[model samples]
Target chain A: MLQAQYVDGRSTRVRTVSLSVSGTDLVITADDLQRAEPLAGVVFDEQLGNAPRRVRLADGAFCEVRDLDGLRALMASARLRDGWVDRAQRHLPWVLMSVVGCVALVAAGYRWGLPWGARMLAQRLPPAISAMLSRQTLKALDGGMLLPSQLDGARQASLRSQFQALRLPDGEPIRWTLLFRRSPALGANAFTLPDGTIVLLDDLVAQLDNDQQVMAVLAHELGHAQGRHGMQLLLRSSAVGAFLAFYLGDFSQLLAAAPAALAQARYSQSLEWQADEYGSAVMRANGMSPALLADALRLLSKSHHDAAGVSYLTSHPPTAERMRRLEELAQLRPVQPSH
Target chain B: MDQTTANAPQPTAAPARQPQPILFTGRGSEYFGIWIVNLLLTIVTLGIYSSWAKVRRLQYFYRHTELAGSTFDFHGRPLRMFYGRLIALGMLLIYSYSVRLHSLVTLLVLALLALVMPWLLRNSLRFRLYNTSWRGTRFHFRGTVAGAYRVFLLNGFLTMITLYIMAPFMHQRLKSYQHDNSWFGRTRCSFHAGAGRFYLVYLLVLAAIIGFFVVLSMAGVFNAFASINAAQHGGGRVDPSAIFRTMLITYGVAILFGVSIGPAFHALINNLVWNNTRIGEHRLECRMSPVKLAWITLTNLLLLVPTIGLFTPWAAVRLAKYQLESVRLLPASDLQEFVDAEPESPGAVGEEAATAFDFDISL
Candidate 1:
């Protein structure tokens, strides 16, 4: 017999009862009152860990059985679902494996899984949606911080026409529009909107010494637009945010936001690198040294004291490292071996 | 009235003052294993199993919380939560993109959310209380959607329009709405407190924080003055090591007190709400010390930093044990005398789960 506290379903009143299995019937005895009900009619709560199991009687009453051994004796192991989870939880080796497995899986998800998913999603999205998004985003930015270009109109025209001549990898003319903008806040920066609109700030155009340097910057923006890096970044971070919300939502309200922010910085840095490589390819295709971008970056960095972000947490990786990489790529081709 | 008083004989027995302390019978090591395993499954399944994880986590906490020899239990199923979570993810996507589409769209989303949040919260509360049971009887929430709107929306608007001066009033109203209509079996729990009490707690915490910053700034200014003067005379070059040291000290001080503020606020409100609440005729007493709670919270923070989030379960259990064990129910009458209220109120488990579009957002 399993000793338990029985409560009639209609009330909170409790009574000490002895429950026993007789044939296919479960017999319940409370004081002098006795009853037998089919054992199949009883409703058992799902067993979790070592929690006291409660069985609701057929007549709306319920029994809480705290006697672990007795309850286990009556019920078959197959009926006790989720027992494996409970057992694995208690096992030290299993727990250690879980810890290692969790870390590795999370790291892998961040490294490959999420990025791959975001790429697929970004590629499938319609161009019209990105155009609308870009329009609204540009409008919002203009309302806040961005200003009309202060650079001379003639210079803007020359740069635009030169950029117009640049061909895509498939030998097609670049389909994106180039706009000139000035921003005191975003000095010496060029960015691509999701809809392939490249915004070249006056600070960057003015800072570059030659046309090659300026074309290199524009090529970098073109890379971002062609690869749909902006859209991919948006999709990726949203996914990461949703995942983080699920994983750490209830547990670490205090610690959750920090990791998500760090991940964003990390993602953007990698995208920046991809855009740079595309810029290097364009530079080599045009018979301009990949080292022109390195020079442009150096000149821009010297003129513009870049203090916008910390070393590791910036959207772009360290400028020196990027410059060194471009220099290395330039060395591979040596400007022109015939020259 | 005088005739009625004279007709009934007064009972000679005084109300018993026996304090039945709440107990938590959960061990950290056992829970750590559970937490790690749940985390692993959640990651592997792309968060599909997160609902199950939440159920397990809640079951552990609920099952261990014992009051007067009766432990609480959660019957919330994971499938319902999984569906709800999927819907919630859709809404999250809309919310995330709305800001980029236009500011007006963002405003529209916020207004729309405010309009329906009360309704959603109402169902969420019902879903929560309806699933929690003790002694074969489930807890019920009698809070109306209208009541939720009044407390959450109307009061929220008023607080905002008043530039948040009425924040204390809103807090008090939220607490009242949460506690007053909550029913355990047939017995209704109630909480009564003025906004002034809330204001007092807020003001005290604010004052302490302000005082801390003021003192720190004063010390910082005095210390920096020497370095600044030296730099001005010493080729306009400040010692890099000196600056680094000063920054380190400032950050250390900030982190030390910053972690305590959240815990302090929660501890104060918990005590305030629990102490004033009455479950049936029994008065609930919670004697939680902000200092002690803050101490545990700080250590938890310190431990989590070192363990890199592995110590989550142990920290949670430690905090739960302290908070739960500090509460006691002062019995006013025989425990069995409190009968279930409204016999017509039944079948919440089957009825609600069938229509379970709501998720326990708190978890």
Candidate 2:
């Protein structure tokens, strides 16, 4: 017999009782063994640490037994259903393995899986949807940050014609449009919308030495558009946000916003490299020197420092590293004669 | 209502006036093992096991906390909690997506949430208290939705309108409502502190913070003026070491202010809350030292940052142990007389919504 406390569940009164196994039936009796109840269809609370095990019966009465061994024997004999989670929790080796495995899985997802998923999703999205998103974004930007192009009409026309003449190596011609804007706050910057709309700021146009350099910068923005970098970035960040919310239970708005801000501010180094490579390829195919892009970047960095203000490089790839890679590409491939 | 009535129970139980300190037997090392396992399982199950993990964590703390000879227990169901979390996550998704798509819809949702927050807070408290028990007798919350709005919302509005000068009064009102409605079995808890006391504590802390900033700015101006004078007299060159010293002094003052003010508020508030709280015929005593609590908090933060939060379980356990040790209960009657009186269970939706929105209603 196992000594225990019994609660009838109808009152707050606590009663002492003795519990015993009788063949297939578990019997609960008062201290005098004069009164008893047959424990059938009772649920046993899973053992947690050294806490007393509670056997809850159908009639709402519960028996709390402190004898761990006696409770285990009775539970085994009755063949009571126990949660698998309870069993797994006790297995130390399995728990350790699960922890290690989970960390590895999250690391793998962060390094590769999420970016690949974003790429696939970005590619599959309908062009019309992308165009609509771009239109909305451009409208918002125009309302707040951007102004109409400040360059002369003739210069704008010439640049437009020059850009139109350049062709990508691909058989299917890329669908694109160029717009000029003057944004003092976003000085010397160029960005591509989800659709093929490219916006080049007046500061960036003025920084370049010639039309070829301007073409080189446009080619880079075109690379972003063709690869759907903007959309991929958006998808990747939202996915990461969801993952973070799952890992860390909802705590603060600041924590939720932090990751999104980080994802937006800095693009992955690999994505920058890919876009650079595409820009170089497009320049070479169009019979322009890839070195023009490198020269433009060098001038922008110098002028940017002279201005003593935050510049386009705030969100772009590290200038020194990107310049070195561009210089290497310029050296590796001889520039084709300009058409 | 009078001193005589309040002192009646005390004189009758004068022989049993010896306070029993609350004990925390949980060890950091033991809790760390459980925490790591909970984290692992939560990740393995893709967060579905988090409800179970939460139960286990709460149970560990509850079982380890002892007063007299008996320990507390948590009886919250994992499945119910899981369902609540799912509902909360769904709501969050809808709210966030709506904010991006439609500003007007988002505004409406925010307004709705604000209106219902008091109801949610009340139910959340009821659910939490109902699930917690000590010595086989459940705790209960008797706060109503109307009471919640009056205390949390109406007082909150007054505080905002007063530019937060009435914040301490609002805090007092909320605490009074919570404590007065809380029960351990058949015995109701009461809070007995004046708004003036709360105001004094808040004002002292606020004044110290403001004084520190004012002093810092004055020093900054003095240093600038001195440096300008020195530069003009010394051939347009100021000593670099002087500038470095000024920067060092500024940083040291800032760190010192932060370290002092944060712990001061926590210690004062905690001591005030527990010391003034009376449950049935019992009263609580809190003896938490501001400096000691501050040191523990500061060290815990320093350790946590360097270890990249791996020491979180240890930090939590350490803090809990210290706080629990600082409290003692003065019983006016037999503890066994406390009976289970609450019969109705609160709806889990409000509790779940509060959890989902990360509302610290316990505060």
Candidate 3:
């Protein structure tokens, strides 16, 4: 028999009692009260860790029992099986499997599933929505970071017309528009918005050699636009943010959000590589050599005094690697073949 | 002689009562195993099993918390919670999209949400409390819808209008409202803390944060940013990682301040709230130390990064153990005389919706 705290159904009164099993009947004995309950009619809470267990009597009364070993013995004798969840928890192997399984599952979801899902969703997003998002982003940037273009209006129009000549692989007209802005604080930068508007900063243009290099930079930005990389990156980071917050609900969301940002740096780096490849193809399709883009990158790299940071942390691929691939492409076609 | 050994016995029907300390029996390793299993199931089911997982998690914590020779229990049904989850998810998606779609849509959704927030929160409290039990009797919430609006919306506006100077007053009002309408079995809980005490706590916490900033500035950590800016102004390449590191340092400092301020606020407020709270004639007391709580929280965060969150279960258990064990009830009598309250069922929509929105009710 195990000592227990007994609470009758109708009242919150607790009575000291003793519990025992005899002939398929659960019996509760108190100083002045003796009660018998059928073993089948009783409800036993699953054993979780070593927490106190509650046995609910058929009449809604319950007994709190702390003697796990004795309770297990009674349950076994009465042919009452333990819950599968508790059974699995007790087995060391199942727990070990889950540890490895959970790690692998989460890693797989992070690496493969999240990116794929984001890419699919990004592509399916409406053009109008992307444009509106782009407008909002540009408006925000214009308010703080970006100033009006320092490049002359004539220069801007000439470059715009030059870039207008570039076409898709199918030779159709492109949808992207190249815009210029000056921001000394931002230093050298060129980026494509979600709506395919490419913003070229004056600092970056000042670092370049010729119109061809500028066109090459624009072509690279076009690649990002065509692939909807901005949208994909946004979706990816948001998805990672949402998932990590849920997965580590016990931990601070602030702590969890850090990893997602680091993960996003990796995602954006891959996107850079894809855009580089596309830029090479687009430049080669036009009369311009792929080396123009390579030259622009070299100049841009020279403009920045720090050529190196942790490559993993950087969103762009290494300049040397990108330039090497561009040089290889340039060598593959020494002269542009006439159609 | 059996029940007559009561010390400090008053000349009344009540027995000589002792302060019964609440106990926590859960260990980290056991909870870790359970958490892993639950996470696996949640992932396998694509988060559909989260409601069930939540139940198991809460049950483990509640059942392990013992007081007066009895442990608490949670009886939330997974199916009702799941239905609530669906509704919450739907509204969340609609609301988030509305923000991006148009300003008018955003305003409409916000208005709708504000109108229903009090009702939703009340239902959530009712559902959560009514499902929680000790000694086979349920706890309950009976705060009215109008009362919730008064405390939540009106007081919230007052706090905002006064530039948060009246925040402590609002907090006192909220705590009193919650406690006054709470019931455990047939015993009603009441609270009557002065807002001045809350204001004192908030003022002290703000001073503590400012003190930390002064000390940090004295330590010359602020000069690190100056050097970074000097390096950037030299027309040299800006190291992105350096900037990232600077941001990280700023975040670390902010978190350190939060660790100090947040725990102190909780400790002071919790102490004040529980000290003034009563269930029937019994009194509740909380003795949490802000320094101890802050140290534990800071260490937990530091350890979590290296372990990649494997330390989470232990950290959670550690905090729970400290916080729960610090609380005790000063019983007016033997503590077993109250009858069960009439059952009032509340839907899971409020609780699940709140979870979906990821806001804490601060219970």
DockQ of each: 0.51, 0.31, 0.36
TM-score between candidate 1 and the true structure = 0.88
Which 10 residues in a row give candidate 1 chain A its minimum summed lDDT?
A: A306-315
Chain A (alone) TM-scores for all candidate structures: 0.85, 0.82, 0.84
lDDT of each: 0.78, 0.75, 0.78
Q: Which ranges in model 3 have alpha carbons more than 4 Å from their true place?
A: A1-6, A15-43, A56-60, A77-79, A306-315, A333-339, B1-16, B87-102, B218-257, B338-363
TM-score winner among the candidates?
A: 1
Query: Lowest-scoring 10 consecutive residues by lDDT in candidate 2 chain B?
Result: B344-353
Q: Considering chain A alone, what is the TM-score of candidate 1?
A: 0.85
lDDT of 1 by residue, A201-301 (tens): 88777777988899988887788998898888878777777676665545455576777778887888888888888888777766677788888888877
What's the CA RMSD for each of the models? 5.2, 5.5, 6.1
Q: Clashes per prediction?
A: 1, 0, 2
Residue-level error in angstroms, candidate 2, position B314: 1.2
Q: Best to worst by TM-score, what's the order?
A: 1, 3, 2
